[model samples]
Target: MADSSSNSLFIKPIYIAFVIAFAFLISSPIGSYAFTAQNVIDSPLLTKKIGTNRTIKVDINGNGEFKSIQAAVDSVPEGNSQWMIIHVRKGIYREKVHIPSSKPYIFLRGNGKGRTSIVWSQSSSDNVESATFKVEAQHFIAFGISFKNEAPTGVAYTSQNQSVAAFVAADKAAFYHCGFYSTHNTLFDYKGRHYYDSCYIQGSIDFIFGRGKSVFHNCEMFVIDDKRLTIRGSITAQNRKSANENSGFVFIKGKVYGVGSTYLGRAKGAHSRVVFAKTYLSITVVPAGWTNWSYVGSTENLYHAEYDCRGPGSESKSRAPWAKQLTKEEVAPLMDVSFIDGTDWLPAWL
Candidate 1:
């Protein structure tokens, strides 16, 4: 037999196996409590509000029914039509939550804005997997919640990253008193008729992007620099495949200001469209106000327009020829909440 001193130096085989398994569990995104349609069904509804639209409670301290938001979402039944309210307590949650398309009419209610935060880190290369929160349902509403992607520029990300904080592919979806923060593609308004009222979005380079038909009312849009990689970045990168897509971003009565020079947007899709009416643009916006990614067949047909904008960056003299200076008549339809069809779905509380 080996000497006792030599045997004492070796760690238990079980301990070595445990350490390897623990490392793999934390780093690998796959095979780690992977969510699927079946997992959602297997989970039981945590708490159901009695009378009016059903309500579920989520508290981080274990006071509520569920501890995590994703568990609360999984508790909901598939094809749920009634308004299921998710009451989230004030706490910082690190989770990648997805509200599948089958679960509709989810109302995320937080105790207060800026206090309840859901954060994650994902890069542009990860594609849709990078979103901290993604709602693929319909008729959804969020009140007083902040979604963020905490991908640091120097360590986790470089100049060209597409980290997304939130992705909403819901129709007639509305957000009130919320905050979205990230560096690249913060708010992916991908495919839907959505409304953002009294909300905040902070980012740089194609932050408020996608093909959704969206309207921002009394919201705040801030452009931030990614570790000084580029002097400027585009605020929006709308991807409208064709003219009849019925997709665009309308910022009505919002403030756009922040560090470093940034353009209003660059065309990721050929028929990309964005309009700013009765909004504030700070000097951080480059005088040019627009940039074409310069790809063949792209940006050539982009529709970037502004009307009644008031700020040092709103001067139309130096703007690109392709961008338009619309008249009051041209922006009437967009000024109303009807642009996102909110008249039919917006709650009376709004």
Candidate 2:
């Protein structure tokens, strides 16, 4: 009705602006991040039918009490001792979560492992900060969750000191039916009395390391292969300071398999001790198991042992001289849950 040429110019500019905006929406990093953090389909593990009654909810999609996990954690009162149950909804939460040492008795329950995933791109060079989920508090329990580190597990991975999926530096912490995914230093058990049950841990080099006194039961310690790795990968790098340190790592009734020719462990600390008792090892394990970090003949101080383990890798005749094949009597002390003194705080264990 107005001048036809004027109307054509107005419509043309508006159409062009809309097209440019749509293209930018698809190409921007914020768009990608939002897509990655979007809510997931309800996982079977996250069903409300499950017995998760006494807990607060964290839904990243704004349908729950909190949108972020860190906010839910911060809501807890300081120095509170009662069990704080935090039920996380299903989503790919792109966050670096940290449970500080001051907080304790925190129970983090995820809907399901395949549903709720916390992912971070931090490298091990960040040390404790490298963990996608850092648990510094004691008396903690996590069920049906996944912590993943998205990094290239190169054969020559010197770029980072040690990237960890979950860095746990607390006493009396327990993980059940959880999944840890990474390449190197996947589970940093940093000086704690902890228990892992029915968890899946995968890594390549020194995957499970630290100075913690932890026991792994019914767990899968998987060693993935790196084609670039000419030198074989190792599973553990325990750092127990001395015999009197009351620090050791024991894996009982567990599965050690995957794509690797790995040593059982390395002596990172002077009196590092590890025991694989009544477990299954695949042929991927090296025969001369257990190596030293630096000093030769350091196996004297290293207490690496295996007892009645099955599979092709468990045959111990060719094992390292420093690593012993323990008898039942010797394995008795390490086999019990009391090895980590879990009776005090391990829920459903006592």
Candidate 3:
């Protein structure tokens, strides 16, 4: 009886060691069950402070060394800072801002939505090849501000082909309670992953165009034109590059209104895809919801789907043959937190 008890005790220690070793293996990066708990715990804290706290408020109207937004951004130390907040006062600042990768995790907060505006007029087809506000900084956030591309509307077929107001080339960026105003290609999601919530974006002719993986929640997309105009233009032109890139544009719980006649969206690239889920579409959306952008061969690869969408434009029978009506089960994985949940390193509601 004593021999049996000793043997059991010896085996219990070995079993415990084995369990611990297995757990360590499972938690490693190569393990299939690798967890991000440590990452979440180790993420840099984001708050409103400078140097130590990471928030640097910039009141353009206040008495400070920096007057323009660009000057304030240039003043901040690069890479060493994590989260920097620029509190812009109520004023119309006509300037082009560029945020480089070296200045990541910068949050631009304005006094009020309509009160602070960044106004500029530039077109992609024009002599200029860059956007009015170009962002290459990851973990960037912009709220309570307006990015206006002041190009005249309805001047279609001109050399000023693609005029973009704000171009985001940053990963894990978010825009809340902001407005993007432009005539064509308003919010350019160049090549990155982003989230936009409760924002107003207006444009015509593929205004919301990009090759980025992005999600827009509870946003308003206005298609502008006069009463006599027909074929206003598509709202989005998602030009995703690769199949493995998770490259697609998602519009959830959004309202689409058109002052003139136009289709909702079109797949501009071969592998481009878009999903309109739980949205309200106005009669401005064309009968055939998805357009090919004059590309006949790309119809098979592009995946344009809709789920639980309502309004005068949500007529599936008249939709394009290429478009799809996704099942509830199919969209379940897409709605998970991980897809849109970036490091969660930024402040909440930013």
Which candidate leads in lDDT?
2
Minimal lDDT window, size 10, model 1 = 41-50
> Which scores higher on lDDT, 2 or 3?
2
Please list the residue runs of candidate 2 whose C-alpha ends up more than 4 Å from where it truly belongs after superposition.
1-54, 154-157
State the displacement of the C-alpha of residue 259, model 1, in Å, after optimal TM-score superposition. 0.7
> lDDT score, residue 251, model 3?
85
Question: What would the per-residue lDDT of candidate 3 be over residues 66-133, giving only the tens digit for each residue?
Answer: 56889878877888355677767778888898888888867787755689888887765642253678
Location of the lowest summed lDDT over 10 successive residues in candidate 3: 37-46
* lDDT per residue as tens, model 1, 65-144: 99999999999999997888899999998999999999988888886567899989877665477889999998787888
Ranking by TM-score: 2, 1, 3
Ranking by lDDT: 2, 1, 3
Best by TM-score: 2
The C-alpha stretches of model 1 lying farther than 4 A from their native spots are 1-53, 154-160, 298-300, 348-350
Every model's TM-score? 0.81, 0.82, 0.80
Q: What would the per-residue lDDT of candidate 2 be over residues 1-350, giving only the tens digit for each residue?
A: 58999999999999999999888876897777467534322323332323344577999999999989999999988885767788898999999888898888788889777888999876755558788999888878888899999876643546564678999998889887789999878999987899987789998888898999999887898989855667667888888887799998999977899975898898888888899988899998898987885644456788999999999999888988889999999999889688988776666431
List of clashing residue pairs for candidate 2: 45-111, 46-111, 124-162, 124-163
